[model samples]
Target: MQLDDALHAAFRREATGLEGIDVAVYEKYDRDPCEPIIGLGPREAPIGFFGRDPGEQEVRWGEPFIGAGGQKVREGLYRAIHGAALPDFEASREVGRLAFWANTVPYKPLGNKAWPMAVKRRFQPLMAAVLVDHWQGRELITLGREAFLWFGINQSRETRQALDAFWKRDDRFETHHDTPLQLENGHAATFRLYPLPHPSPLNQTWYRRFPDLLAARLESLDAARRLG
Candidate 1:
């Protein structure tokens, strides 16, 4: 199946639960279509950020990764790949890698809010399907703890141990010595699973080194590809 079609199906399946939520407030406001919270492009593309909600008073655009955080993420991506403040997609396209973005949840939660654990659980499988179908079994570079947890890669005793070590050492990307965590679907993949602090302005300290970290990860991917 084409990745977009797969995503559409997965999103529909996952978002079925949203219909049951008390959307009375949303109904009071005009019911415009919820914009897609993910973007799918070629396999080699950079995946952008996907948040749970669009800002108030903003027109919902079709693509994911719009607004201030999107802008910062774009800037960071450009700096990482080309050492520039902005990426010229036309130029980047010539280098043979493209970028795509997706979110675990496809709809904006009520109150411009964080997703509930139950909601997140319902949505995660669809998100995983999108990742697996689109990336075709490639290792993922998840951006934050939420993404890691949503992708089902952060539930091991070893991972907890690693986090404990990081707490003691005050290191961000603490090593787990290759721990394996099982996903809902029972398919397993091993990843280095770097734990970045969230990129939100609320966590400005984490955002400072975000670009460099992403660049280094990209470089590692390149080196691994060469070795393979």
Candidate 2:
């Protein structure tokens, strides 16, 4: 938990300067505003998910990806794996445990907006460390543009530009991109990033398609059998 300690300490130092976060909800939960609200699966999980941040439901539940938007993703996984719909929130969360789940900031920003890029940068190294040190899987399903492009945070200029270009392509979601990342501990690997739209009710255009898109992704990964 050294990385957690380090990240929490760093967050405490800079959280006062941060804006666009629901301080009241954190207060209500008696949760330290600086604590990262992450969702972690068992170390044996075969795949991981990268998201933007937590929401009100996440803060209330003391975990990420349990809100309405996350429930959609969870339901998709369960449906794809079990060939049936999720029966309840508990079952959805159960399916969530079959994979790794994390986010860029791991906190709830105000109005459910994405965390500021500056905050994401401050915690990027430790976040990367969490993924590298905990998860043995290199395949990640990144939800939305922010989650996918976050891989380029500390990468070279050319790499960042290329990732942006890839995001704009028509076949972006159907394609998988490899992003090379190195932890401070010298562990390096290329993580396979599969792009997908964020499954939020607020995202009207793509919200309806998220289930089908996610089902295809899970099928392509053979995730059901792997999890089984």
Candidate 3:
């Protein structure tokens, strides 16, 4: 399926599982075209980042990530990936590979509440399909523990052990800490998975090392490309 089609499917699947969420009064934001907030690249890059927004539903135009935590994420992506003081989405595409940006719970989280476990669980398969079908199994980079956990990698003791080892070693790529567990017909192999602490202000401790961690991950990607 095409990327848009796959994305829409995933969105619908996720939305359907929210029956118990009391979304009657909640406003729904229309899916807008993915635009670069900050440089010049293909209007259609395939890589993306997903998250949960814990606030109001109406998203402002020209703004992607929508809160302090989101701002920090943008900062991390900019400084770590683009080597910039602030994010320039246009410039980001020039350096690293990312085509799109999305969220599992695309709408801002209600009352700063965590997403329901059922909603998260139901959304994962659809999310995995979007990654596999649309991006044709391109590289993926997910931030936050929740996203990692949703991807089904958390169930593996080996993967958890790897993450722990990487943490203890204070490794750059943290290759030991995270492993690429395949999903949906080996789509997971197209890229690597880097699960860092959430960029939310709550996790300020992780921000200090964000750049270094991202840089190391990028280097590994480059190395893998060379080897291939």
Steric collisions counted per model: 6, 0, 10
Residues 126-218, model 2: lDDT tens digits:
788787876678899999999999988877787788789889999888878887877767877789999999998878988998898998899
Supply the TM-score for candidate 2: 0.91
* Candidate 3: Cα lDDT at 131: 51
Clash pairs detected, candidate 2: none
Best-to-worst ranking by TM-score: 2, 1, 3
TM-score of each: 0.65, 0.91, 0.60
Q: Please identify model 1 stretches exceeding 4 Å from their true place.
A: 1-7, 16-36, 44-59, 87-97, 153-169, 174-186, 222-228
- How do the residues 1-228 of candidate 3 rate in per-residue lDDT, one tens digit apiece? 234655565565555545444243242444332211211112345434555533442244333354555555555455554445764644433333333454555444445577777666555555555554455434444566665555453235766565545545543337523355455555554345555556665667786776666556545555223211
Runs of candidate 2 exceeding 4 Å displacement: 1-17
lDDT of 1 by residue, 131-197 (tens): 5545533444455566555544335676666545543545554332233545566765544444554
lDDT per model, in order?
0.51, 0.83, 0.48
> Model 1 Cα RMSD, Å?
5.5
The candidate 2 region of ten consecutive residues with least summed lDDT is 1-10
Least accurate stretch of 10 residues (summed lDDT) in model 3?
33-42
Error of 1 at 182 (Å): 5.0
Error of 3 at 210 (Å): 2.6
Candidate 1 achieves a global lDDT of 0.51
Ranking by lDDT: 2, 1, 3
Residue 154 error, candidate 2, Å: 1.1
